[model samples]
Target: MYFIGELEGSSPDLKISLYKWNAKFFVKFETADLEQVYKISEMDVSEAEVRAMVTEEFIQKIIQRFKEMYEDLGELMGDY
Candidate 1:
């Protein structure tokens, strides 16, 4: 897969990347040093389409995933 571009967020380091892999598009969002990827089909897909797919709910899911990962790590480390 190759990178199409990145979307800048409110935070300087927080960003979203759009990638093209064959006939599909991949979205990469990074938060709290964790990265999450989302995939969408390429049917009639355009830059705007890919950009539009990232809903507020989806972003929240990304954040939740990060939190879950952190918790999992803490558990593994016996951090309570």
Candidate 2:
């Protein structure tokens, strides 16, 4: 497993790591305190190529969803 790169200034502290096993690329996204993994079968592309597919816009979308979930949970907890 090799750490390809990371995105800075992300809302939930996102980091990307790549692991190659049996000629398969495993793209791991560490967002906030959660770990999400995506498998990519393309092994002939550069690290930048993988990063391009996982764009900042996509990450922002996930972050927005997470924020909304947390906000809703907080409200529910307050009512308890």
Candidate 3:
């Protein structure tokens, strides 16, 4: 994967990064222990458009997914 750049406006605790690999672009949203990635075909959108896609609402959805993932982990760890 080739590092593109990081996105701004993500929650302080969350990190958002952009990458390109295999003719695709990857948008990665990560918290300390959880992460979500979105893949887009390079032909589908340009890098600038990809950045534009990460709107505030999208970040909220990513945050929610992280919460769900953490909850699932907690269940698997017996609520540890």
Which portions of model 3 miss their true places by more than 4 Å? none
TM-score of each: 0.73, 0.54, 0.92
lDDT of 3 by residue, 1-80 (tens): 99998998666799999999999999999888888899999999999999999999988888888888988898999945
**Among all windows of ten consecutive residues in candidate 3, which has the lowest summed lDDT?**
4-13
Local accuracy by lDDT, each model: 0.77, 0.66, 0.91
Tens digits of lDDT, candidate 1, 20-76: 997889988876566778788789778788787777777777767788987888898
Which candidate number maximizes lDDT?
3
Cα RMSD (Å) per model? 2.7, 4.0, 1.5
- Candidate 2, residue 39: the lDDT equals 78
Instruction: Look at candidate 1 and tell me the lDDT of residue 11.
Output: 51
Worst 10 residues of 2 by lDDT: 3-12
At residue 77, candidate 3 shows an lDDT of: 100
Candidate 1 ranges beyond 4 A from true positions: 8-10
Question: Which sequence of candidate numbers ranks them by TM-score, best first?
Answer: 3, 1, 2
* Model 2 spans with C-alpha error above 4 angstroms: 2-12, 43-46, 65-80
Give the C-alpha miss distance for residue 24 in model 1, angstroms. Answer: 1.1
